[model samples]
Target: MNKLLCSILLATSVSFAGLISTTDVTVDGVNTITKNYQFTPNPADLGDLSHDRATAWGISGVSLANGETVTGASLKIENLRNWELNEWNSLFIDLLWWAPEGVTTYKDQNMGYGYGKDDDYFVGKESEFGTVNLTRLNYNVFSGSDGMYANPSEGVTISLDGYKREGFNKIFPLYDVTIDFSDSELATLTSYLNDGNFGLGIDADCHFYNDGFNLSLTTQKTSDVPEPCSLSLMLIGLTSLGGAFVIKKRK
Candidate 1:
């Protein structure tokens, strides 16, 4: 290979940034039919990592294809742990398979996870950025290190750009929003959302990603209905329907 030509190609490739192809599989209502992303890393970069015991773990950024081209992918996890079961928080995550990237996240990513910050003492957080209930575990998602959890007001919409600038960029790669709390859900969601742009806010720096993700799940909140906010939607819908009926009657 010509040294000068190789350098030129590399530079040009980096400048364009490729795209990741995502796909979705339909199942039914209320439940999902897919999860996770899949990608084939550069043969050279794949190197010995695939076989390296030390490198045996979840996917990495290097897997991302050049020009937005992704070599692998993950769920857009936000508040990714909850339900204090035993002595650790139940890990949480979201679906990112439908995000603009060609990758199957679950089968490829889950190969390496569950090794806690200190020994195997906690539930490893999973994908699909959504509400979690880690209070049961008694331990925060990130205790020793490389741990993070989020709690959020379910059904609410938020802009992730702020979270991105604040370090929640990992969860914002795709614009698809998921609301799940189980490992299965994580894998399912990531696989289904393989090509969507979900605005997720995950702060992956701290061993705990302690960005304060507060979610008002039904388990914790005594009242399902928050006062002053109940009558808004139903009332509006009913009123519109009534007006339409009256107009029809006059005609």
Candidate 2:
């Protein structure tokens, strides 16, 4: 029985393929028709305080390909800046998959506050960033040195480790937000596979410190076959039944 179960596990493992891709980063629910922006940490430039002003950033692209079923997916971003002066406080971040109302196009030429402008931007203020909450995670938190673990707040938390403007240890480790899709959600995603467009939302409640984070999205193709754990359980149940039948025959 053990050998049979092991063979089942190995077979299921080889039946699936994994794919990783990135789309243009869109902000505030505006689809990236022309361009997308990316943020990276630089200690020298404070003049272009644009990345620091954005309340959210996301990717617009194929979350699942044709004929592929999503077994697992994850969103990864670097929490580059949290400029709060308070030392005791930590930033709590939420990752979401979203949809927008109507069609809106926003452009950013410079990807900064002064250079780019979004005329059709949907989120007006922190109070009104309604689109972000449209829908959304199993998330794990870790530092560059610390091991990953589930956080208590159900969101990633970053501590204020240093002072602002100088010697700021704002470079947080990668924030990995696992995308958990229910059976119905997986069915819904099939409708969008052709267009490959989906809304990714990020929110840091503090409002001011929600900027300067980089984004990446990943999707893994899951096989239709049962998982090893599930198969093992089923096999165990069947073996028990077989054992009972043998005892009855011997009696």
* TM-score of model number 1: 0.17
Checking candidate 2 for backbone clashes, the offending pairs are 61-196
Each model's lDDT comes to 0.26, 0.32
Clash count per candidate: 77, 1
What would the per-residue lDDT of candidate 1 be over residues 10-79, giving only the tens digit for each residue?
Answer: 1100011122333433332222222223223222111222211111111222221212222222322233
In candidate 1, which residue ranges exceed 4 Å CA deviation?
1-28, 31-36, 42-46, 49-251
- What TM-score against the true fold does each predicted structure earn? 0.17, 0.33
* Candidate that would win on TM-score: 2
| Poorest stretch of ten by lDDT in candidate 1 | 5-14
Query: Can you tell me which runs of candidate 2 are displaced by over 4 Å?
Result: 1-58, 63-66, 79-81, 87-195, 203-251
Candidate number of the best lDDT: 2
